[model samples]
Target: MKLAVVGGGSTYTPELIDGFARLRDTLPVEELVLVDPAAERLELVGGLARRIFARQGHGGRIVTTSDLDAGIEGADAVLLQLRVGGQAAREQDETWPLECGCVGQETTGAGGLAKALRTVPVVLDIAERVRRTNPGAWIIDFTNPVGIVTRALLEAGHKAVGLCNVAIGFQRKFAGMLGVAPVDVHLDHVGLNHLTWETGVRLGGPEDENVLPKLLAEHGDAVAADLRMPRDVLDRLGVVPSYYLRYYYAHDEVVREQRTKPSRAAEVAEMERELLKMYGDPELAEKPALLGKRGGAYYSEAAVDLAASLLGAGGSPYQVVNTYNKGTLPFLPDDAVIEVQAAVGKSGPHPLPVPSVDPLYAGLMANVTAYEDLALQAALHGGRDRVFRALLAHPLVGQYAYADALTDQLIAHNREHLAWA
Candidate 1:
């Protein structure tokens, strides 16, 4: 099968290459194309990719190019990992929100809104081109604000599925803690992307016994520590919340911490510099250990599994993915994209049935779904009012003053990206 990576020049690409090399039997890619506008970075990353593949004795052909159309032409699958304005824009997204006493995160609040607006247009154009070049190709989006981006693709009538590493990361960690293989542990992971909860941890299959209570009783402290939340909070909630939920559960405290530290974007920028330097070395045949600290842990494995299943190759039958709700949650609209466990195959992901959601988490999910709805509107048809309305609706920025201030800052920082600005 031919597979194309749209942002293969990124420092994160080698980790993906490592997975592709290791899991060749899962998604036997015949021709792999790396598409990026940055010629220098593409060459550096592409060279390392080939070396990694050769080191693992995979026979796939590796190609690199700046032309998106040419790179994806006739490919069976196109993966979208592009960043519209690069890390410079991300820096702005991570810092400006703190000015409003809000969390400066890349996938939530004002920062996420800015990213959605900048990213949606570019991704749509790419999807349109992919449709024209290869109508049968599947689009796997690993882009930030995945819920919004995936919704855009599906609404535009393209075959797409959203992938994230959160569920896989959780599964691996839980398995190591439980002294079991990763495949034997199944998570009842549900909610929207980045805003999800592990309602249950089952063994063997979706209908198997739930071991979540045992895990909490024995390892709640460690889980809480990893999430930077108090152990008592987990006890009170009776469920494990994703680290992203910390932004909501402790908004003011998170804002204070964010204000004191350098933005994550800045730290990642420095890490990318070092990672690119490491990628240039001819002797480096494996992904560097430093890449682990660069984040997106287990992203490659998640991508490979999702891509393989979508292309009718072998992959895990049930996995967590972002797809249409279709009444899985009575509270959410049918078209709302949610992250949940699903039976994945060539047709697409069919989200497994979920138990009734507690009012607390369901309320928040409904609220954010509304915010996402407005965010998509602002992205598709740009205007100052729509942006302001979306910000006002967000649970993080519900106040009129903060929404007004954030809207101005978002527009000012992103004027070059927003054609209507």
Candidate 2:
């Protein structure tokens, strides 16, 4: 099968290449193209990707190109991993929102809306190009603001699925704790992308066995440590919230913490510089250890499984993915994109039915879903009012005063990325 990575210049490419090398039997990528506008980084990254494949004795041809049209033409699948404005824009996204007492995050508050507005337009343009090249090709999006981007793609009628490593990462962690394979750990993971909770941690499928309570009873401290939450919170909720929930569950404290630290983007920028330098070393054949600190752990595994299943490569029948709700949550609009367990096949992901959620979780999910609606609107039709409304709808930036200030700050910091600005 052929695969194209639109942002293959990314340092994260080697991790992906490493997975491709190790799991050659699973996906059998025949031709891999790394597409990027930044030619210099692409060269370094492409070199490392080649080295990775050669070191593993994998014979797949690795191609690099600055031309998007030629790179994705006739590919079986196209993976979107591009960052619209790079780390500089992300730094602004992580810092400006904090001035309004909102969570200074790249994907959770006013910052997330800013990212959506900048990203959606570019992604749509790319998706349109992909359709022109090969209308039947599947689009696997790993871009940030995934729910919004995936929604944009689906609304435009593209065959797309959003992938995030969160669920798979959790499964791997839980598996290690249970001394089982990652595939054997099934999760009743529900809610929107980045904003989700593990309501059930089962062995095998949903009908197999529920070990959530047992996990909490014995490994609560370890699990709590991973989430950076307290054990009591896990015990109280009978569920584990994704780390992104920390922005909501502890807004004030998070804001205070963010105020004191350097922006994550800044740290990542420096790390990328080091990674690119490492990629230039001809002797370096494996993914560097420093890459783990860059986050998005186990992303390649998730991508491979999703792609293999979607391409009918014969993988698992079910996995966690970001797709339309289709009444899975009952409360969310059927068109609204949600991340949850889904049955996968050549036709694409069919979201599994999500069980009833507690009022505590349901209320937040509903609130966020409404905000996502407005966020998508602002992203599709750029205007100050749409931006203001979306921010006001967010639980974290509900106050009119904060919303007004955040809207302006978000626009000012992202003027270049926002065409309407």
**Number of the top candidate by lDDT?**
1
Weakest 10 consecutive residues, lDDT, candidate 1? 75-84
Q: After superposition, how far is residue 228 of candidate 1 from its true place, in Å?
A: 0.3
Off by over 4 Å in 1: none
* Candidate 2 displacement at residue 206 in angstroms: 1.5
Task: Give the per-residue Cα lDDT of candidate 2 at 24.
Answer: 90
- lDDT to native, each model: 0.96, 0.93
Q: Which residue pairs of candidate 2 clash?
A: none
lDDT of candidate 1 over 200-319, digit per residue (tens): 999899999999999999999999999999999999999999999999999999999989989999999999999999999999999999999988999999999999999999899998
Superposition error at 150 for model 1 (Å) = 0.3
Off by over 4 Å in 2: none
**What lDDT, from 0 to 1, does candidate 1 have?**
0.96
TM-score (all chains, Cα) for each model: 0.99, 0.99
The alpha-carbon lDDT assigned to residue 195 of candidate 1 equals 96
Candidate 2 lDDT by residue in tens digits, 258-289: 99989899999999999999999999999999
